[model samples]
Target: MDYKYIEQLLERYWACETSLQEEQILRTFFQQQEVPEHLMAYKAIFDVQQEQAEATLGEEFDERILEMIEGDPVKAIPLRGGLRRRSFLRPLYQAAGLVALILTIGIAAQHSFDEEGQSQHTQFAQTDSLERPADEFVTVPETQEAAVTVEQDSINLTR
Candidate 1:
């Protein structure tokens, strides 16, 4: 019949001045079957609010969710044996390989150059020795007869 109080409460609600109790009263008044024509427009809104307030999750729902969480746990990888140790030693192995390669190359180069050097040294000694005067060359004798001959030659040269 009279909607003066409802109209006043709605005005306060629109103005952001209604208390929680006043809002509850408004929601309860709208739940009636024969709502005033002008207020019928607001019934749908209050009904949805009431439905949402009454909706809730049961204990069985919570139990099922907990069981699912406990059923499939995250698995951790094992780092036993030499799996992790080998990772740290990987650089050491690489350095050792590098040193072995350098040494191999160095020794090969030295041997290759040393062969050429020996041939050059022998050629230079033969040619240069033959070009020098025989009197300037001193000879060492290994036998007694050769030593005596060398001494007699030196004595004759001194004379």
Candidate 2:
């Protein structure tokens, strides 16, 4: 019946000057069953907002959502000696740590084996460089005399 007042309030609302009470009055006026045809467009917006405001979920909603996400029932296990809550990611952290440890060990073992192989190659090269051919052997007269004297001393000791 008095659409003039509602129009004035809407103008103030669009200009960002309407108070909260005035906005509430506008909403309440739109909620009436017999809305004017000219104001029918705004009626839908307020009606949808009211419906959304009234929509609610039951107490089991969170449990159902958690079950759907985790594929199992979630339980709050209490800590034994601490007051703080433990995180659900603790197991994931442990698993990641185990994987990191295994990877580190594997990498270290691989590096160690590589170093051993390299050292063995180096040792072999050094030994090869130090080795002489059989033809390079030469006998000296002093060595022969020393050998004979050593043999004679051994014979004297046996006697």
Candidate 3:
């Protein structure tokens, strides 16, 4: 039999260029009992591929792999709806706290300004009382003393 096509496909497979169908053809051809002496050497390679294709893991494969890696079988914990509700309200709670902080600062600043204004008004009133003339002055019996007192009052008025 002419095996020129098989030889060509083997060349392509060695060069990593064979399509899936062509590779399957090679595997099937090698599976036959009587293979050409020249191609007999490659039959073992295709036989291994066939064996691997038919291989499967047992039903406990996943559990065994997990146990090997983690040393124990891990159970999945179900999450509560409360976690979702808390996540939804987290931003609202932060916003409320921020607003309260801003209001506190604003109130403190307003209170400080009001106190400063009141102090200024009190200082102005004290200065105004000091500048106002007294209701009574000391009466001098002597004319010379009265003249001295009048001159002193004139000097105080100028100040």
Candidate 4:
């Protein structure tokens, strides 16, 4: 085969106009040790690509990356700098929850006191229907004469 077509393809390859099939043809053409003296420049390009095609970052690379992560666990926390890094908010939330808990307990205690007061009022109403006057329950106002009776008796005894 005349290498004129191969030379044309090489020009196309350098110009980046060659398709994958054309590139593959070039690789096969360069794989032959016997090439015309003019095509020697292309051998290095194809040979480098062939060598790199077999190249790989092996398990040693994986081990190195693992070692790097284990050596500094702080760097492993991805994008932590952009996250909400405020420790203050944790304490603030705890304080707010504590305040809410205390308010709930206080409101419950207040409700209990109200219930006790209502029960006492109802008991007073039931007891009020008995022979004893509701005044005996100690909620009534004292008469002026009854109030002064003790004072007058004390004065009379003193006199």
The top-ranked prediction according to TM-score is 4
- Per-residue CA lDDT of candidate 3, range 31-75, in tens? 998999999889988888888988898879988777666663223
**Residue-by-residue lDDT tens digits, candidate 2, 1-159:** 678999999889889999999989988998999899988998898899899999899979988777677663244443453323234444544444444334333433443455554333333322332231111222123233333443444344346
Which ranges of candidate 3 are over 4 A from the true structure? 60-74, 77-159
Q: Judged by TM-score relative to the true structure, which candidate is superior, 2 or 3?
A: 3
lDDT string, candidate 1, 1-159, tens digits: 789999999889879899999998998898888888888778888888888999999999988877766654432344565666665566655554444334333433443455654333333333332333232212111122233433343344346
Candidate 2: segments with Cα more than 4 A from true spot: 62-159
Better of 1 and 2 by lDDT: 1
Using TM-score as the yardstick, the better of models 2 and 4 is: 4
- As for lDDT, the candidate ahead, 3 or 4, is 3
lDDT of 3 at 45: 89
- Per residue, candidate 4 scores C-alpha lDDT tens digits across 1-159 of 698899899889989999999999999999989888877877988889999999888999999888878866656645454243443245554444444334333433443455554333333332332222222322222222222333343344346
* Candidate number with the higher TM-score (1 or 2): 1
**Segments of candidate 4 deviating more than 4 angstroms:** 60-88, 114-159
- Residue 94: error of model 2 in Å? 22
Least accurate 10 contiguous residues by lDDT in model 1: 135-144
